[model samples]
Every structure is written in structure tokens, then in C-alpha cells.
Target: MMILALLGVLALAVGGCVCVVWAERGGPRWVRVVATITLAAGKVVQYSAKNRRRGLGGSNSADD
Candidate 1:
């Protein structure tokens, strides 16, 4: 349990550090936007690598 808690905290800290690093760097707006997108899409990259995950299946149902 203690090890799991430590890992979770470590993950949170690392993620926060990444965000800080991303925000601090100076670059063009497009570069920043691309960086943000890349950072966000990183998690989904595993699915792409496996080529098993799918998309939303044409379900554009967004209730605002």
C-alpha cells in the first residue's frame, strides 16, 4: 500500500513537472499549440502503436 501511494504521488509530481516545463518554454503560438496537442495525445499513442484501438465510431453526439 505504501509503495502504491508513493508511485501515485511520483506520477502526479512528474506530470506536474512536465506541465511546468511545457508552460515555461518560449516558442511560437503554433509550436506551443502543437506541443500541447502532442503532450495530450501521448497517452493515446499506445493505442496507435498496438493498432488495436479504434475511434469514436462516427458518434458525434455532443450535448452542450
Candidate 2:
């Protein structure tokens, strides 16, 4: 479950990176800002899960 959660985050990151680069070419300022925030939030959530898996929480291993 943890891995799945992190996978979703990573998938978003990959797709978002592509979109952001494309947006940089011609999209609006808000697109950049929104994408940046979305990417950052995904990363933060992923890291939080990772930390939880490191035994900081009662959660299962990220490998699970």
C-alpha cells in the first residue's frame, strides 16, 4: 500500500515534469505555479510515507 501510494506520487511527478516543461514553452503563469505546488505536495506526501515506513509510525514497510 505504501509503495502504491509512492508510485502514484512518482507517476504524477514524471507526468508533471513533462507538462511543466511544455508549459514553460508557452503556458500561463498560473499553470507553472499550480504544477509546482502539486509536484511539491506529492513529494512531501511521499516523504511522509517514507518516514512513516522507517518506523516513525506504526505503518508497514514501504517495500510492502
Candidate 3:
């Protein structure tokens, strides 16, 4: 079951990447929308991780 879930995620990631490339080449409107949303979501997750890492150094205290 876990392997199947992993495969599903892999397939989605691959498909999203393909869609991104296709959108860059002037693909359909829906593909462009999907690619843009996927890219934005990825950026949000990336920034969230960066913020979490930055706070890990005990610098999040209110003792400014």
C-alpha cells in the first residue's frame, strides 16, 4: 500500500513537471493554469521550510 502511494506521488510529480514544460511552450490554457498553481505551491512550501530552518537557531524569542 505504501509503495502504491509513493508511486502515485511520483506520477503526479512527473506529470506536473511535464505540464510545466508544456506550458512554457505555449500549451493549452488549463495546462498553464495547473503549472502556475503547482509552481506557486512549491514556492510556498519551500519558503515555509526555509522559515522553519531559520527559526531553529533559537532566534524566534520575543526578547528583541
RMSD of each: 9.6, 7.7, 3.4
Local accuracy of candidate 3 as per-residue lDDT tens digits, 1-64: 9999999988988888888999999999999998998799789989999989878755756445
Q: Pick the candidate with the highest lDDT.
A: 3
Most accurate candidate by TM-score: 3
Q: What is the lDDT of residue 43 in candidate 2?
A: 89
Model 2: ten consecutive residues of lowest lDDT: 55-64
Model 1 residue 56 distance off true place after TM-score fit, in angstroms: 57
| Best of the two (1, 3) by lDDT | 3
Cα displacement (Å) at residue 42, model 3: 0.9
Error of 1 at 61 (Å): 68
Query: Which regions of candidate 3 fall more than 4 Å away from where they truly are?
Result: 59-64
Lowest lDDT 10-mer window, candidate 3? 55-64
Q: State each model's CA lDDT, in order.
A: 0.62, 0.77, 0.88
lDDT of 2 at 28: 80
The residue-by-residue lDDT of candidate 1 on 7-52, one tens digit each, is 9978865765566466668755665665576566665767676564
Candidate with better TM-score, 1 vs 2: 2
Judge candidate 1 at residue 52 and give its lDDT: 44
TM-scores for all candidates: the values are 0.38, 0.49, 0.79
Candidate 3: lDDT of 58? 58
